[model samples]
Target chain A: MNTKILRNLAFTIFTCYVTIAVSETPHWSHDEQSTWWAIQDTTQNVPLNYPFGECGIGKHQSPVDLASATIIDSKSLNKLAALYDTDTAPVFFNSGHGIQVNTSEDYSGVLMIGEESFPLIQFHFHEPSEHVVGGKSFPAELHYVHINEDGRIIVLAVAVDIGEENPVFGTILDNIPHEEGGQNASSGIQINPAELLPADLDPANLDYYTVAGSLTTPPCSEGVQWYLLPKVITISAAQLVQLKDIYTNNARAPQNLNGRSLLSTQ
Target chain B: MLIKLFLAVSLSLSVASCFAESDGNKSKSLIDPSQQKRLSTDSSQQKQAAQPNASTKSTDSQSPQNSNQENKPSMIDFCRKNPC
Candidate 1:
């Protein structure tokens, strides 16, 4: 055999293996829908897709159209109290769905619900805005997840639109890994969750819609407390496009309100 | 010269045989059982339903405690499009 021919043959075989090894495997559910395509497969899996399906039969599902609800007097609504620390380093994970930033144990940030307080756990983003307001879905949504002592979850969701570049989101998005399933840790940089919100967002003056719903993802567990802030945060077009490239069309369609009341402050 | 030609033909045939075998088994290996099981486990974990707290539940229902519990991946693993 010619030495060059032998070498070429080996190289071709090696290339084949490498290509296959690097390719991502599709993750399918029993209903034959995957997280990547499940939102769009709604027409097929009515039982398993958005609005219904899972361990719980989607009674009060999240990502609902906020515009459909009635607005109450803002003063009558209970004020949200957040004691977020200004000094702390948060670690970010890709989580395949969006960039998940985990709060460290020592962060001491907590969202107070009257007497019961839930510590800030983590926050992630969903593009094209999961919850629709005024018959329009924004470019993105940010969810700040917290948990009480009993393992109950409450999510503080903020809707985002493209306008100006968000400095905090800019810092986070700059370190995002191009490859899926990759996480990067911020070194020597401390980030306060407060920085993620608008500087003018006063908790006392803010009007938000409160609802009881299930987790947007699988397990689709119920009993999650949700508060959707009415104010829209702005992100740059480039930042939105960068995030979209990572998880194109990642937003889950708004679920049926299911006779659920969407209460908000005026 | 005939011997050399025969040697080249034989080498070409061997290379073609290797390619054929890999091609035949590629699909089967791609769906390896271990990988399937891992995916199955993830889907199975989604079966754990959250205790229903009817939509009427209010935030002030529970008394405030200085709870500082750390967050774990107790909920289903989150990814945007691809498998996490």
Candidate 2:
């Protein structure tokens, strides 16, 4: 009888352990960004702590204010070469945080910096812009996230302003799922990410300001290479309304520069 | 026998919780020690190289270039329609 009781007790303990392990994945949101380091659950009157790292202590955080006085003209910096697939259909989703577009599994696109190439993983947007330029904030910003084989990250940021309607951007807005945690896949809509660039700019020799920073979100991992394109892309005021309706002020405020220098390929 | 089983279960839970905590720490330290040292070295070199241009401020709100006109890219009227 004692042996049978022991077996049942062991099984129950194992099940409880598995449940705890799965539930421990930290839940975070932009609602209380100041408390992102230690998110609290006050719904049950008991504090369920979900702590994050680096965000509270990292020296090289991202979304910094880019000013000309602090920027360095690095002639050694190479021009950005982005080789993106022009005909692949990408999946658009609203990930509660922002409107995100995930590249198809077979879609092969690359952002070349120097000799190293980082594969395009996914891209997302931030309202009212994240990185401020010369103390001026734009209507929105787009981040094209890439990752290399060595697990390094390089995020390319483009500032968006209110102007003429961008048909390609409009296609993304039309297909975006209105509700949070919603996704639109297999829409049979093909979007060439290159079209999102400035109409006059060349993809092979793009000019940008490079800096070392971290992820704006939780865990806020540092050592990410940031490439901020100085040129701005245009979207109509109505399109801005469509984006804001889905996510308004969904951007983390600019963090301290912490003595980081912006390197530009002028 | 009940006391022994209870102790074993408690020990297991402690170890599992430790593993979970360590996983979070691991993600925070994704860049290894060698890479961290290399990054610190590169940052020092960049700071030294950028010292010359750190003091020159320009009033041009449209561009990120300083008073050095040679470094400025040819001004393209890309945002003439919607001047921010």
Candidate 3:
């Protein structure tokens, strides 16, 4: 089992958390002077590449591998829409996905952050990403990022494990383009953001770790929100390999936990 | 400072290694079983799927740098030519 440490709203992560997407992003070009000329770009955040990984000391880190956690609230968090079906066009540029998501504008059944309807902009993926749970890791991690009119981020992370059939995942997995270049040309698999949430839905299991971490990849943006779910999900062997073969090691090891706290609604 | 950095680096290596090994098993599942299904789309994985050409944007386009992925690896090239 993933390291299920006593789930603690780590003080360092509280100040952060906010913040997923496509299977195989399209090709891109980078230039130093370009508008996207960011040293720690979103695609490659090559900080201190330690032999096994990088040593994140003063960095605001996430993905703390789950060890132990508690669910204060056991009540079911009402649902909006379980079946996420839409024609929303995802804008995957540079190294992230930017789609507008809101309570009114639905995708499967992902809830909106602020009251008013906001667009679920774009979501993206990160391997061994910054957010860690109870000090553990999953084969892969997914983030469903939604933003409000004011540009505030509400990210829902879904951990991926190996399994027989991921009912909710099949929707997204079945549609992900198996080939390259092909992914962008085609639309995403028909699904919603709700099915990917934990079965509990209780505010208790909803532990978070917020850190002032940068994008795991290049042009690593700073101040961006990083919401890491305490619970990790499962997928199939074939699916994991499919993901690995396409992107290889796409995750940018953890950063320094400059002392942040992980907040939860529960 | 050096000792702390060394410890941090060592912990990072172990963590990375642990992630790799744990991932290899692929049998254990997490509490949020539906997470896989719900994560149909998000910012990061979408970057892996197809990174848009930020240079060319319509009125509604966002900043490319704010999006996802460095570049698809060589393996994906085959799929691009053949497609699924």
Candidate 4:
């Protein structure tokens, strides 16, 4: 082969290899689908297109400290009605960030705030809780992400306090997929969403702090209404260890409130 | 012959563009957001704690909400006079 032809062929092959490698390797610091560390990458934190991927820039970002909030009368506050099913099995999957419980049509429920209610889409856990109270974090936090007919989002956050074994956590923790992107049907087991709520969690008596914030994860879209249940639900310490073992640091740092009002139903 | 030349030119252009984009991406650093902000501001401050004990048990029972008026009744006032 001619020396010139050989050199050209080598150049072409090298260029092709570089292209393939770059395309195959996920962007380390931006894609939340692959790793937890990238959420910490501030430059790429706000989506290149502002507001949508911009959790850092969004005024109503979530996981705020509830300690500094205004108190209101509880009598006028509406109760939280979680209509969960016991018959249908909920799908549990590991969404790289954390273990998520995907709700089925049969297992679907609605969380009524007042006349407006959001359909319970799915729930997931963040080890060591996301939102803090008095600057104190909990063992875990469960987020029931609800979307309404208008496509608005309202998240119901439950702080999990480690204590006696919780049946709901038992079912979920038992089926946690160790590998990233792994998912499993709960082995045809039916897990009640209501069971995940503390038995003594009376919404009327539950004084929750509300905030207008974006989703904690990527594509942190704004306008998410957060209803944080101060009532602590119990899951065994062993379960907490099992959860942390999967993703040691999946939670994002709480963003600045930017003067957003944090209301409470006391 | 003309068509073949056009195809070759297009292929080379696509490959060149791909290489250019990838090169641009490679130049960007993967610094943590907090660190990146501090660096840009030229401030010498300690890194924010990762809050490792975020999952530890706490006696503080404060739990946190939003203040949208239109969404207010739908969220907090719905189950008050109405059935759950």
Docking class of 2: incorrect
Best by DockQ: 3
Assess every candidate by TM-score.
0.63, 0.68, 0.46, 0.61
After superposition, candidate 3 runs with Cα above 4 Å error: A1-110, A114-118, A128-130, A133-135, A178-181, A184-189, A202-213, B1-84
Winner on TM-score between 1 and 3 is 1
Error of 3 at B40 (Å): 35
lDDT of 3 by residue, B1-84 (tens): 999999999999999999998666543334343322121224442332111123442221211223333222221221122110
Local accuracy by lDDT, each model: 0.60, 0.66, 0.39, 0.58
User: lDDT by residue for model 2 over A1-266, one digit each (tens)?
Assistant: 99999999999999998776654435667777777866543332332343354677777777787752255563356558888876467878777678877777667788877566867767788898888755567899888887655455678888888878889888888898988768788899887887887655678888776777777876576656678875778899999999988888877788887667666655
Candidate 1 — which pairs collide?
A74-A266, A96-B79, A96-B80, A97-B79, A97-B80, A115-B63, A115-B64, A116-B63, A116-B64
Off by over 4 Å in 2: A1-24, A40-51, B1-84
Most accurate candidate by lDDT: 2
TM-score of 4: 0.61
- Given candidate 3, what's the lDDT at residue A266? 31
Candidate 2, DockQ score (0 to 1): 0.01
- Model 2 TM-score is 0.68
RMSD, each candidate, Å?
A: 26.8, 25.8, 22.9, 27.3
Tell me the tens digit of each residue's lDDT in model 1 across A1-266.
69999999999999987676433333333233234333332223454444324423555666677656433332234557666775466766677666767776567888765555777877888877778755567788888888755566778888777777888888777766766567666555577887666445675344455767766765455667787765667788999988887766666677777666554443
